[model samples]
Target: MQNEINIPIILASVRKIGDAFLKQYKQNTIPQSMDELLKQLEDIDVLCLTSLKKDLTATFFHMPWHIGDEFDTESQKESTIKGDYWLCDAMDGAIQYLQHIPGWTINLAFIRDGKPLFSVIYDPLATEMFWAKEGAGAYMNGKPLMVSKKTDLGVMLSVFEYGHQDKSTNQLNKEIGMTVTRLLDNFGIVRNYGPHGLQLAYVGAGRIDLFIQEDIDTYNWIAGMLIAKESGAEILNADGIPWQWGSESLLVARKSITEKYLEIKSLK
Candidate 1:
């Protein structure tokens, strides 16, 4: 028999009551609180999927990647970027909203292999829950989600994070921009929400069609990719390649939808 590597996982329960910073929920509900739903995720990450994830931790601020900064190994050396504890305190900082409610965050964690094994983006403000597992699938608050059927270059809607707008014209930007411009040449809409968890969730839920990013860091992909897969979206590189951690990433929807979008948009 071949040798197998068993991954040990650890996760703690984090409760968020009342209005916290969640992206957007599909529908409005009474109480409008995610405390109970979030509690469920605490177990989903540790008990159900722990074998694939390990060394997990979450905080408001984690990696310090700027617009022009490369997500390659070099980015890790920037000491100026703060650590976990600093971010934890910052999340509950006085000037920030934590001063009043004592709970608000961008849920982040890592698995044993240094990849973003699993994660959730809870924007209580918008009431959106973005969660994922590494390979199995991704979801938002138990409901199945997916990208829009609108793939036409003219009619597609796009999602992006912050750094892409401010960074230099890097290859990541080039590839994405080319894709967006091609789509926009027909009238596609590109939108940026400043968070990957939410961005990925939106795509999976079919709220928007396409979401692209240069930084496929573990934190962003772990939960996001799973949700996309579960929601029936396609995950791969833009040039018809597979998507893997620690590399450039592109998320496309189903072939029928994409083909339809392409035909309607009419890109040569």
Candidate 2:
């Protein structure tokens, strides 16, 4: 497609799809298995996909099938289309959903020329929808979302890796344990409610001061980076790279605090 869709129209479509999926989630209609949950979530993805396809094809007269549907890893890697595609994490926190946790969210983003253009993260349980359009700023439930201005990591509520029971072989999980101890000694602590999407949204919403994780997939963090960035938060990867769609690690915080944390980490 030629990317002719209006921003407002994309937002409206995402909201509709999010609301539809959320209804099923709240009604407990989706099955519990990972396969089943993903299947149902994919159904919603189809709805969003169809809406986008119809609108764009009708208006622009072309639709790229590569971005028109969700697929497995190999299929994605082998995709023919090289630019302007839709990205979706229909179920952002599968484990949480499996365990009946309340932190899971729905993520949708439209990436153009390798950058996020529009994004939305919706928490069905809380009835909160966070969205943003490039250069326009982000909002949650009709109000603008902003990152915290806190400059001190001390007394800051940071979210680290949660749900890691095996500390033996999971290198990142082990690091999170050590980091938690360090933060506790320095007047902070790791609060893990188990969803990276929601944690990033919280940082954007100023509900939390910082969030760091060692490993993450694109689907889990794409919409989040857009939400965080549009809300004025600083995002970086473990290697200090500016956060992007393919980064494997993430560190999100207020700008000043992120600088201090990186400085501190560099010392060890």
Candidate 3:
């Protein structure tokens, strides 16, 4: 199945979209107010979907598809349907983009039976493309990618996101705060670099040692998780169980330090 995928064509399509998106991104001024920011975000989503939905559908007409906007609260409550489909986030870092930050990206994944079969993440500003196939390994700009071999929790760089604020509960916020506190106390550097996909791609590239998040959405995880996994990172739930599509929390870490990270996560 992996061999049958036309990687070059897929990459070209995503790159074309990224290039166009980046051009518009550069033309816009940094949003000066909350209202302006929200407006820009809506505009960007429309621009992304307008191009991406049309191109992807025409490019791979047979596959089913889902975009980030479609997975709202009610839809998320339903179980994931079993089948092959294209899962994409047209603007993975909408906030960063509106703020004129450089951490956004276009994320795409091909999932079969709820497992990623092929994935690609494009950072238009950086012109870096990260991709992976089930057994073919992960890559950035055609070079093979691998997770960090760092074993010392004290010296590792870790990243995380608190998930959507609109849906966050007091309990979820508290857990995120506690986890961030714990990580900051132990790791050399802890920060959030905005886009979830890029953060996971960074782990796959050994740019960061760990990534953890609570209540991650399917679109936020699938592609990047595949890249991290192919680069030899461990994908597990907060409790150290193997991660599945609907897992509430996510932990992607380098192999040598995964157990230690899990231990820290279990701390009272």
Candidate 4:
């Protein structure tokens, strides 16, 4: 599958879109408000999708931000095709981007016959791109990326977050809140970078050891999950089953850390 297309050229085109958006932001062309920035990102997404569509014949799927006047008519649901499908998150850390944070990323994954064939995650601020083809191993900035073998749960840096802020009445949030509270108390340190992609990328790079998020969306976790998996990280759904794109939740970490985390999750 790696030889099916020009990987270098396709990745370069993806990076170009990210670089252009970051350049415009550095030039102060992007507004500070979430509404304004999201509106602008929609336009950027169109440019990206257009460029990708021109280069590949795959069916594309992306978040429905209702970015442009032309976007209103587009279907918000995921699209399935007979050949290949592209899963993209044009701007991963929307909240971080709106807050002028430097941790957001851009993601793209190619799915063929229901399997993830390749993935690329771009961090424009750091000018680093992480990519992997199935069975080819992961890389960052052209260097190989590998997960840390640290198995100690107490010594590992962890990232965790729930989907909602109000946990008082939400059953799922309540359960997640309890789980995250205990994790924070037990793990070395905890964080939520407002973007799941960066968290997964960091785990792949061995910068972070654990990541757990409840009710995550498919587009947000798919690309990074593949990158992490290729880097030798373990990932599972809430039920401790193998991870899938539309799973109810995601728990990705080093092998030992994931085992202990799952044990704790089961007690609840």
Candidate 5:
């Protein structure tokens, strides 16, 4: 199935859609109320999804396609049944985009049996296109990506993402707080970026040394996981075990720093 796929063609289609969305994004004004913001978000989602579905279906009609937000509710139930399907987040960092921020991106991944085969993440504002193919390697704007070689925890920059508010629980809140506290105490710098996927890509590009998130939504990070993994970053769960599709938490760090990071995590 991987051999039959043409990543370049798929990337081209996604990039075209991303470019169009970027134009609309720039013209959009900030909503005055929460209700208004949500309404506009819905409209944008429909527009991006419609265009993506139409273009991708024209070329790869046989493969099924699922939107990122719907994956948890729909695909999780059908976990036993999987082949080749396209999973796309038409507008990653939707909040940032609506607010006219620069961190938004378009993310797409081809999954085979719950594992990413190939993926593309387009940062429209930065004009940076990140991609990865299983066993091939990760790249950004045609340049190969590599994780940072820094092994010292005190000098490493880390990132943490908060889970959706609707899914937040007391335990999750405590976990987030403790994690951030730990990062602040040890890491050189810590930040929470707009798009989760882009932060993972940043780790792959060696721009960030660590990325940890609890209660992760699989669809939002799966594409970036492959990119980071292919770029030689270590993908692990909070328990220090190797990461898999259904892990509730994620910790991505450079290969050179994994052991040291894990040791620090163990101290907690």
Candidate 6:
């Protein structure tokens, strides 16, 4: 008797927006993590998202098994792994952990195939929220934003989280290494963190000139992509791809910065 959202309708709109983004850019934005999404349950309405937040948490549990395949090689290593969900052998552990996960860390998104069409990120402590509709653009606290245009690679700042200690898989480490080495050799400045979203927003808002990420999916990229595109920023694959719809390895920066940075790093 809740009489709230119509799941099919809401998801359909998400798909529409996602399709437009694909028509223009040919790819989708990555999504935020589930636990991160769960943490923001209180602000669910504020982000204008669906009741799926609570439902999703429960659904993951009743679904029988967790999908560890969501993560690629970069997130599998013990050193690079931050959440239990990233480990290949930890599917059971992830399901168990998710069962008890706090509602405050939720980060929700709607993606198409491998790209994000719409997204909302709610950060309770910081009390900051971010959301986006592809082609419609990115937003933070209702304010429109853009990415940096600085192209000096040496001057460009970068970030990488939790990949330095273990290369047991080496898949994530290698890709990250290649991307960072290019950034450092060219941009010369780099940093790391344990979480995402906020870091990407900084890049879109021009607070940071450039950001290179090795492990990214639809939920993580969508909102930030809107912010960057509206600001006239651009995103691409580190290997010089034009950012396909399902790409897992993504690089985002100000348009001016991306061109110059890529040239210096020989990325494109």
Best by TM-score: 5
Better of 2 and 6 by lDDT: 2
Would you give me the overall lDDT of model 2? Answer: 0.68
Residue-level lDDT of model 5, residues 68-187, one tens digit each, is 663353343333438888887877888888887788888988888878889999987789999999999999999999999886777788998865534534588888888899889888
* Deviating ranges (above 4 Å) for candidate 2: 26-81, 162-170
* Each model's backbone clash number: 21, 0, 0, 0, 0, 37
Question: If scored against the real structure, what TM-score would every candidate get?
Answer: 0.54, 0.77, 0.90, 0.82, 0.92, 0.56
RMSD, every candidate, angstroms: 11.1, 4.2, 2.5, 4.8, 2.2, 12.5
Worst 10 residues of 2 by lDDT: 68-77
lDDT of 6 by residue, 42-139 (tens): 22222222333233434233212112223453432213222212111111112212333311222444433344445554443344555566677767
What is the number of residue pairs that collide in model 1?
21
- lDDT string for model 2 (122-207, tens) is 77678788888888898998899999887666678887754323336658676766667655665365587676777888889998
Predicted structure 3, TM vs. truth: 0.90
Go through the candidates in order and give each one's C-alpha lDDT: 0.45, 0.68, 0.81, 0.71, 0.82, 0.48
What would the per-residue lDDT of candidate 1 be over residues 76-151, giving only the tens digit for each residue?
2232333221111111111123222322334444333334445454555555556665665556655656567663
**Model 1: per-residue Cα lDDT at residue 138:** 58
Q: After superposition, how far is residue 30 of candidate 3 from its true place, in Å?
A: 4.1
Worst 10 residues of 4 by lDDT: 64-73
Question: How good is model 6 by TM-score?
Answer: 0.56
